[model samples]
Target: MSKLVFQSVAVNTDPMTQPTPTPALSAPDLTEIQTGRLADPFSLLGPSHRGHAGHLVVHLPDAQRVTAVIDGTAYPLAAQAPGVFAGMIPPGSAYILRVGNGSPENGAQEWEQEDPYRFGPVLGELDEYLIGEGTHQRLWHVLGARVIRHEGVEGTCFALWAPSAQAVAVVGDFNQWDARRAPMRPRGTTGVWELFIPGVAEGASYKYRIIGPDGRELPLKADPIGFGSEHPPQTASVVRSITGYGWRDAAWLEGRAEAQDRRAPMSVYEVHLGSWRKRGDRPLSYVEAATELVDYAVDMGFTHIELMPISEHPFAGSWGYQPVGLYAPTVRHGPPHEFRDLVDAAHARGLGIILDWVPGHFPSDAHGLAQFDGTALYEHADPREGFHPDWNTCIYNFGRREVVNYLTSNALYWLEEYHIDGLRVDAVASMLYRDYSRKAGEWVPNIHGGRENLEAIALLQRVNTLTYGAVPGSMMIAEESTSFPGVSRPVDAGGLGFGFKWNMGWMNDTLRYMEHAPIHRRHHHHLMTFGIDYAFSENFILPISHDEVVHGKGAMIAKMPGDAWEKFANLRAYYGYMWGHPGKKLLFMGCEFAQAHEWNHDAELDWAALSRPENAGIQRLVRDLNTLYRGTPALHARDCEAEGFAWLDGGATDISVFAWARFGGPGDDPVVVIANMTPVERPGWRCAFPQAGHWDEVLNTDAAIYGGGNRGNMGGVVTEAVAHHGHAQSAQITLPPLSTVMFRYRGAE
Candidate 1:
């Protein structure tokens, strides 16, 4: 079998439906690309300067007589002005325009030792950019041309923008670093260097080296908008358009979209594929990863699957945060299209896909966007706008028009190009702060000197607005750790406009309280009520993020108190409480089971933890939690929708049990949830329900399947109820030690 033997199947959302129309890719106009025609320059150039137009106007001053030299043919300028020139030039072609000084008294001049007009703007083919002033021109041709595949052609084209280089050669894993074997030929009039490799196709990595005027050959340069990487010393990745994959998730996307529209409960299983599992030998392909993990998520009953940074990163363990190329999915995991297939497969299984997009910072690797076009193109020029000290990365100048478009284009790229349903913006706090990771002397204040980063804020707001406007179903999630007000609020309503923000404080406080509480006095009366107090502040996702379970913090299951049994019980109780709380939920990999060690990406997740009943119990509890969430509306229906929930009790007997009613008719069943933080089981405890009759146990953290003592109220059975509360009949319920129980009852419905 050949390398290109993979199938190219469209992952349809409707198996019987036709595919959607392809999006448009329009090239810019021609006159906007040329500064002056190479055919005739003497008449076009004035006595003073020569100018070209693209996004910005470049003025070349102190020029004398100008003439066009192309294919050994000369064209004299008609003297449009003394030395200034104006004419049209076609894109994808190159011609030389020479200048020499005339008489000084005649307003003509010659070059001095350090003359500024000695050089002209280098012309190269420009890739279609959707952002910046370049958007106005609509198209550009700088030093390179798009090298597209031709049918039945066993060749490749080398395009570049090196007008000053004496020669350019393509090298890499393909040519064995030999320059002479593949010398680039000059094409038409465009400065583009062209070449065709007879045997090289997709997946064959290659790079280009430019031989300078001094006869020095530089290494291959990474594509400015490449979607993948083999970074630094490594050549640019080979092309593999993602129009290929075997996907089966068409129905899943439709169902999931409907559920999301209905504001249904969503529990996401966040994974870092490389870290999730790795055998000792070769890595698992994307297909294998999808097969292995998709079923696990479905079995666990999670409604969504969130992946960590999957964009191509050079390092194996940077958590995909230090992205070198935004266009390429990490080739380490697999090809670009394989990731799409994985997502499509997941969607087919009723799972929503959320990507971790890091536009806040980029790595400083040579093959990355540190500096492109021989300038600070992708970043700001000064320390005030360019660098991130904490992560040791490069910060994009969001204030710049091109920068805004770059990131905004990136935001739309994943959604439009890869069919991702949502983005979880990482390091939002860093993006929002100018003083982030900076000491007094190191920090650069904004113009107002108020510690506010307006540019970043504007960029985020634009991102949210543009992302939501372009793709209504796509979600904008923020990992903003600080108390950034209105993180989940709409932009027009004086908020940052994120659909959801990670509830870091809630996670930290709850975990701290849970870990410190003694089994006997684990009452944590004050801490247990934290969720109800600020739950309405924003749309939040309670995350047991990878940050919490790594770097010696130990596993979430290990955060529980006491012996193995107690620990399992404690974890179940914690999860049960979190689920019942008024927020959406997300669990990092390895947290589903009670792994013994902190997560290590280089190592496989401790699957052996399942052998331990305590660990297995935690996993079962999570699955049960997902089921319960789907089964009961009282838990998650009110999370993002308008005022769908209210807390009836906050200080109820140092136990912090609360009552909440989901969005439904007034006569619908009201869910009564009770949590006993104290190790004292309130047996035969009477809790007041809104209606009379009996209430069945929907979910119990102490259930036997979840590795508990099986002290649960039987389901589907009716019982007599007694009332102690005002104006309503109540039911008598049994509360297990350090556990939570939820019951639905509405006038015996």
Candidate 2:
């Protein structure tokens, strides 16, 4: 007997018959591969050992015939089962799979491509270790579909974290959406599935088809870290390049690091880009908004434009609050690069752009992160810990390190990737409390049995710290309504580490007080003066945001309890008062012109309202107020300092009149602000002045041009060396009816 070997198949050259060895893949493995539930598809499929020869296995249900093409030789693969093809071949480093055409069973078009499983894992050992530990700060750089060149072949690499899944596969147009064709290889212990398919290019739509650990097939899921997604109603994630954007705001960025000081004047114009101004009911593109919104904000003297949430959201009604794709900017406006253009355009016009970020809860859409991997991987498993009653959404499990990293990276993504100047974190109060909107026994308490959500607190602190440290000049503002202490303090100082907090209390109080009839306002005068008691407690932004004008609350102008002319006067007076108040300012889009109707997300603002003089006057008043607030040191220099403000006549409730003085640094000019909330004009109202000098009436809400009766001091009044309101100097001037006035001392007359 002589031993012999074949080139592609090893065999003994004995003349006596000996049965050939069985195939490498058994019947059970073939069944698993055909059903697409094989936990270890890599073990049976792809290249494997068969006796002394190498075997190639491929599962293509649509293919009529398949051949393993190694070098120039084509080896036919026998159909072991429907969609399951296998054959023995010579050992080789590379091979391609050719399918269709040449089979007698079914005649189909022929297509040849590199086998996806032939490539090794895209992520390295460090990536696996960090991801498993949930501390991969730049998870977006790894998990999402990234275009890379592997083995000198350029293609997109798809990776997903589905630890509990029995199997995962990359299904896209390239593979004709066949799950079995591109089965991914599971990395060791990371629960991450990755496959690098050569020749897949940018703009290719893709998703993961995961088989649950229970052996049940699941709905295909969109990529959690998708860089871009199709427009709403289309859930597939699109492969997009995150780089190659040319920024022209270097000067703005450099100056912003030093110029965005707490003491500096910041007047933000909050806008919903979708409803701001649509072209015949269609929303403006990012480029259009860049030119229109940027120029308008600049002309109006606003320092920043706080855009309502722009993250990728499924429902338009949620207004980006129930965002599904945290890493992707919504495609409603335009592509990601166009959004970047909007930010760059804003900076070019010397205006900062602030994004309203929502990280509190996510919608439980079927295609979203809910029940991802058939497990509570991103959220809490218990409803008491994960569900948000108020929002009817799922709260992120901030206690999970991976969830925290996901959110923290999202914050930095907007700031560093898009050059966003700041983020107005939305619904932070809900995130801060475990029993936010739940009744007794309906919520779970922290380890200390308190209402505080310690994990969410820690997450906020870490995100804030990371944001401010990583992105210079980036601001993190909290829309937290509760009295959570030190919200705007540094993280190391045991605070939530926000740059500013929205003054919801002040907004509510002032709005309520303004709603009362002028005569009745005298009794509630405390509402006007009470905010100052704790004005310096936290850095604040006085926001007349969209929330106040929507949901049947009526517009800001409608909140005024007066006739047409009186209403205009009252609103102008309020505008002046707010600009003169001790805090940064934010005004919603239509509030500047006193929009008649409440804000509707479906419609554009009432730009026609400005055609009326009263509305135009309000707009002009707001613009002037912004100018005055930005230019005057006394008004904004120490807006967050207690020593900057003093009450000159806050006790005059019976007369519906209040007066105050704002002081600046030594030698800087001082300003006097007085408001007569009543409809009665006082001819000779005396208020304490900072010095004995000529006090120039810099801004009068009752000026005729501002749709007022022109009842004010003539140009200015000379301060008299008379004791009044606890000051050595006093000025007696005409107080406009239902109006606010501001004066600055010029020099000794």
Model 1 worst lDDT run, 10 consecutive residues: 111-120
Candidate 1 has what TM-score? 0.75
Positional deviation of residue 402's Cα in model 1 after best superposition, in angstroms: 2.1
Candidate 1 stretches with Cα past 4 Å from truth are 1-200, 208-220, 231-235, 244-256, 519-524, 653-668, 716-727, 746-749
TM-score for each predicted model, relative to the true structure: 0.75, 0.94
Q: How many clashing pairs in candidate 2?
A: 0
lDDT of 2 by residue, 582-629 (tens): 999999999999999999999999999899999999999999999998
- What tens digits encode model 1's per-residue C-alpha lDDT throughout 147-214? 34433333334444344455666665655655543555544343344444434556666666665555
**Whole-model Cα lDDT per candidate?**
0.64, 0.86
Looking at model 2, residue 405 earns an lDDT score of: 79
